[model samples]
Target: YCMSPGIVLTNACDSVRLYGKLSLRRCNMDDDDVQWPFEHEVLLSLTHPAGEAEIHLQVDPWRDFGWYRKPSESNNMSVCYSLRSVDLDELTRDGYVFEDQLRIKCKVVP
Candidate 1:
């Protein structure tokens, strides 16, 4: 997983969006012996210092990017989401980010 900061979220002054990526699998789809054959859709719930709620978001990443564990796109896995300012602030507050406020789980899909 990797995170990039300083993403502008809204028209509000000094607001930013946090970008994140999570790798769920690393096997090629053509490999019959691979365990995960079906695509994965991630379900996430983020906890913030301001409040806690399950924000429904599309799992699509920026179109120019491909969601894969390796250089190949023929993998049976994909999912992504956008992060909020309060969540990002809490994550990087002390000049060091240790834990992710987002709790994620996966569900297999065709």
Candidate 2:
């Protein structure tokens, strides 16, 4: 996960920027069994205090990108999103934030 300060919008200045990126980082352990360049749809969600506040986002893998291909000594990140594109303010207002902590979930569809 990566985070940064609020980003300015060109068209809608009042609109909030994304919370940050949620990425799939490769582990150092050998993953020869796994196929290269993921080709599945990813389901990402933010746990909400109120069930109605839960947010779900779907992302398609960038199979053609080198970052999503085979890994090297340095574990690379593949298939990414902006915390599934949920803004910080929205998350907080929706009860997705608790005690300054946020919970995120991910699922890959083959």
Candidate 3:
């Protein structure tokens, strides 16, 4: 698990300050062209000094592999996850804020 800071802005100059951390656990995946089940979690914390701000999370899979194919064809293989929505306030109330703990499950195919 690692911690990082991110800034999100809503409506022009109006921005809400928040922070989140990512956790990556080892998952079992077969070495074949099939989707495997994987699980992970993300914790976040949002603070609004004015008490009128909204916070959102963006989850993106960071791939560390590349594809190889014939040069004549455009062989571009990339796998990533899009940002998913998670209620920050609800998560915070449940003690799943930044620095806290959370769990997420997913499936990957290759």
Candidate 4:
């Protein structure tokens, strides 16, 4: 088993485009020894009282990398991603500005 250590947002918590990066770190929490080479897409979903939208991004750190084998037996590892051309501020500022807490959500793409 593994535990998601939450997400680290870049650029002082401001919006990001193709220039920003996000890192997701997970730690080993169970019988699994030497976890590696996992493939999955991460979706960044933005939700508001009015509506919501989801965007998919590559994570092997970024760009759909296959076979990301990180030899970590200690339980510290991370996945990074390059932000797409989406602007968060503009998305939320359409009418109601989202309080920082209700901004975005991170998920493992299914």
Q: Judged by lDDT, which candidate is best? A: 2
The lDDT of model 2 is 0.53
Which lDDT values do the candidates have, in the order given?
A: 0.38, 0.53, 0.35, 0.44
Worst 10 residues of 1 by lDDT: 1-10
Judging by TM-score against the true structure, name the best candidate: 2
Per-residue lDDT tens digits for candidate 1, residues 10-81, read 334554444433444443345555543214433333334445433333233344455443434323233444
Clashes of 2: 0
- Report the lDDT tens digits of candidate 2 across residue range 1-110: 12111212122366554433334444644465555425676666676765665576666656667765555544455335533455667667777778987666666667
TM-score of each: 0.35, 0.65, 0.24, 0.47
lDDT of 4 by residue, 1-110 (tens): 34232334445456543222344234654425633324455555445646645444444343344313443453434545434544545645653245544445565555
**RMSD for each of the candidates:** 7.7, 5.4, 11.0, 5.5
Per-residue lDDT of 70 in model 3: 14
Candidate 3 residue spans exceeding 4 A from truth: 1-79, 97-99, 108-110
- Candidate 3 matches the true fold with a TM-score of 0.24
Error of 2 at 34 (Å): 2.7
| TM-score attained by model 2 | 0.65
lDDT of 1 at 38: 19
Candidate 3, 1-110: lDDT as tens digits:
11223333223234332333232322243335433222233323343433445354444444333322111232233222235444445556645444653333222232
TM-score, model 4 to reference: 0.47
